[model samples]
Target: MLRIGSGAGFSGDRLEPAVELAEKGKLDYLVLECLAERTIALAQKRKKSDAAMGYDPLLEKRIRSLLPVLKQNNVRLITNMGAANPLGGAKKIIEIADELGLHVKVAAVTGDDVLPYILKKCDSLEFKPRLSENVSILSANAYMGASTIVPAIETGADVIITGRVADPSLFLAPMIHHFGWSTSDYELMGKGTVIGHLLECGGQLTGGFFADPGKKDVGGLAHLGFPLAEVQPDGSALLTKLPGTGGALTLRTVKEQLLYEVMDPSSYITPDVIADFTTVSLREDGNDRIVVTGGSGKERPSELKVSIGYDAGFLGEGEITYAGENAVGRAELAGAVIQERLQDCYEELTVDYIGITSAHRGSFSYEGIPYEVRLRVAGKTYEREKAKRIGEEVEALYTNGPAGGGGARKYLNEVIGIVSAMVPMDIVEAELQVMEVKPNGA
Candidate 1:
């Protein structure tokens, strides 16, 4: 039986917490997923000169803290925290292991950086690019399937490092490698992959954001529970938490997690197969252990969906409240005034009243009327100066409009600007490249 634990790792602190949980849980495999296209871009900026291996130095520091525990428990781990450079990450891991006198094999999965291959393939196929005006002829990486990770496992690597494999595939690879499960066994491997999905978010399954709404003052949520998976040969898996851990595992908790990111209730696609979520069943087996049974799989799609984020322009929003007779009507007029003021400076500014009960008042309002109203104004601009200017205008309207009679007040405004990209579907398969290091003779 193989038990896999997973954690999301965009930041060092986010994933570092998992090490303690893994050690305490006595898990067989721990997987950390940390790549989104934006994550790659951030890694790129940090390592601008090298253009390949610049990851958050916090990752190295975090890993160094876990090395002793990992060696002590003989617990193997896999992580895509390598960012854009697997070898660079691997070199660091090996050096740390050597210094600590831990004899662990580290394998770097390469060729998974198929940004070049994807761009070349786009020339042959008329891929409909839906994201940006700039032609993304480069750096479009597909969320590669678990197959590429097998070579890293075969290399006797105690720890496998990767780049852009799908988040769930990080956990699935270890199961496939350990069980010698074939890719053709879609039903089985799909089950294992789904197991990874359950654990990916760390505390979601463990009553973090969700719990029985009726249950008050629950036990020991200060530490919370981590996801645990029980796997067998047939690919049927049971989900649970560590023994004596703090959380509940009713059918509702498990089902809530299963549907977390699912866009369609029926067709949930992964690189390996189209998982049919509608057919999934859950049963309570024991304390904190839920049996996930049923649900078969179909063949995977021809293309992969890549998530890319790039440079968008800039945006800001501010809010104010008004309380008095005809508050709702007065708030609408104030909003219109704010929009007209913003139009003078920004061509694309917009405003809306968000929280007032009367925003939805006309729909069915034979009932009691609202005593007060809240209004919000939002603006988007290509230039930061214009965005700030529009923000000041909206706040000025609060104390100077018809609603100004209601003693309106304004709060601080928010502003932001960043380069974002939404990467199209592409593939980054891993190829094993090895070199024999000269031995230090005794």
Candidate 2:
């Protein structure tokens, strides 16, 4: 049996929960999945500015906090913290380990960035025509799977860093290496994939995102613990979190995570296998523990999903609050004022009344007016100055329009748009390199 714990779900996740898992979860491997579609795109922009700055911003902090305990417990670490540069991330980890006087082996799996290859083979590649036209490609990464990661694990690396791979593959790789599961073993691989999916989101399955107040009550969310999976050699798993922790691991929580981000539950495609979530079954084995089984799989997909990012435009946003006596009416008037002012400056504009029609977009009845309402104006433009003007016009509404309007806020940000395309698996290659760190003064 292997005990693998999820240390992080996204890039900005809290570190204390991971520390708790490493210290108390008795984990064989602690995997942190920090990269998201937008996160990697931003990382590519950062790497373009500085050669050594593409990985997760908190990579060093996470390592510095958890390295000692992980080393002491002999639990290996696996992560895709190497957002755009795996080698750079590996060097940073080695440097941190050296400073801590800890001898550690770090392995980095690379070759996921396939931008150059895609550009060269654009005419021959099997993807949409739109993928090649009308946009500057900032980053193009193919989602690698456990096959490339298994070699690093086999080398007994203390820490494994990867650039861009499927999130579940981070957890699945260790299971494959530990159990020697054959790639063609679709049923077992499917089971392992199910375990990976459940544990991949860190606290989502452990009740972090499952709270609904009066409906689905979860306690101690402030100190909510991450999740762990006790996976057997047969690929079946028992999902649970640390005892006395802040979150619950009930069947409802598990089911919610099971369907998260799943477009087609019958065919959840990945680089490794096509897992069928519809065939899966769950049963409560004990308190805060559910037995997972019946995850079957077919052959792996022929093409890998590629995340392509490009600069879309710039977004400008501004908000103002109106309170007391006809607040809704005043807020509506303020929104109209800003829209009228910036009609020609922006390509698109939106006027939302925060309290009345922001969420439903006027779908619900507006019979009862609220005591306070916030007026938000947002616009997008190719020109940065034009985008900034949207917020400037909204901020000017304080002196020129509406009574009792206060708490003005404005911001402008670059928009990085992401699109998904398919690349043949045979064209993209994955490689692993290992680096060993000695004591600091050695």
Candidate 3:
């Protein structure tokens, strides 16, 4: 059985769980699935500023913490933490290895950035009026498949980092490399995809997202363990986590994860194959173990989905807290005062009595007077300066409108909007650059 573990589910996932699995779970491969559409766009923005800053900000910390454990445990690392710059991420890894006086082989997979390709070939693109006429296209990256990573695995790399690869492909590539499964073998590919999908969102398969204090009361949440899969060559696998660790891997946890973000159960599209989740079978095998089998795939898609990010605009926000008697009234007045002040600048502004109606947005009034409340004001505009006015207005509320206003805070950022485009698979290529670091500094 080949053991694979998931270190992270998203860009900001906790790093300690991954270290736990590498040191104690006896995993053969550990995959960190970072990089979402918005995060990548943000990374691209950072890259535009510093060229080398596009990769995951946590890459260095995660690597420094896990490298020794992984090296000692003989566990290989695979991650998409490269974000927009796989090469830069690889360089950082080599530098870390050299600093630690360890021997390591690292591979950086590339060619997923399809911004230039889409611009030159496709015109009236998927997102708007016209690709050239509207929207500043910040990034365009195709979802690469397992085949892209197979070469890196073959190079005996201790750590493999990639950009814009499909989440499932990160896990599937190791299955293909170890089991010698053919990329064209749709049946095995589909089955393996199932394993990858389940473990992609690390803690979700554990108790991180499953815990409901009363309804689904789960144990060991304080230090929730990440997921791992013990696979057979035929693609059947047992999903579980490190023993004595936080969280349970029961049938409920497995089932909840099965349909998470899945639109059509039978036709889940990925870069590698068209998987059908309808045929999947799951059963509880003792405690903290779910045996998963079935779920097959047909041929891969002719076209790949590319996530295109645009400069949506700038968002400005500010908040002030009001507490004690008639706090709700004071907070409401503060919001109203800001609204009237900005009435000429905007037709409508997002002014919320946070504790009163921030979530439901004026739906379901507070039955009883709240002892404390917060007033929040926000607005979005194309111009950055206009956005600043939102926070400026909220700050003035302390002395101008609301009494007992304290702990005021404000924020502003360039909002990123994501849209999808379909590009021919032939247009994008996945390239690999492998490097080595030894104590000798070679």
Name the candidate, 2 or 3, with the larger lDDT value. 3
Q: Pairing residues by index, what is the TM-score of model 1?
A: 0.77
- Give the winner by lDDT: 3
> What ranking of all candidate models by TM-score puts the best one first?
2, 3, 1
Scanning candidate 2 in windows of ten residues, the lowest lDDT window is 125-134
Flag clash pairs in model 3. none
Please provide, for model 3 over 154-258, each residue's C-alpha lDDT reduced to its tens digit, 9 standing for 90 to 100.
999999999899999999999999999999999899999999999999999997888888899999798899999999999999999988899989899999998
The reply for model 2, stretches above 4 Å from the true place, is 123-132, 365-367, 440-442
Cα miss at 249, model 2 (Å)? Answer: 0.7
The global C-alpha lDDT for each of the candidates, from Candidate 1 onward, is 0.66, 0.89, 0.91
**Candidate 1's C-alpha lDDT?**
0.66
Poorest 10 consecutive residues by lDDT, candidate 3:
124-133
Q: What is the C-alpha RMSD of each candidate to the true structure, in Å?
A: 5.2, 1.6, 1.9
Give the CA lDDT, 0 to 100, for residue 154 in model 1.
79
Predicted structure 3, TM vs. truth: 0.95
User: Is candidate 1 or 3 superior in TM-score?
Assistant: 3
Question: How many backbone collisions does model 3 have?
Answer: 0
Which sections of candidate 3 miss by over 4 Å?
A: 128-132, 362-367
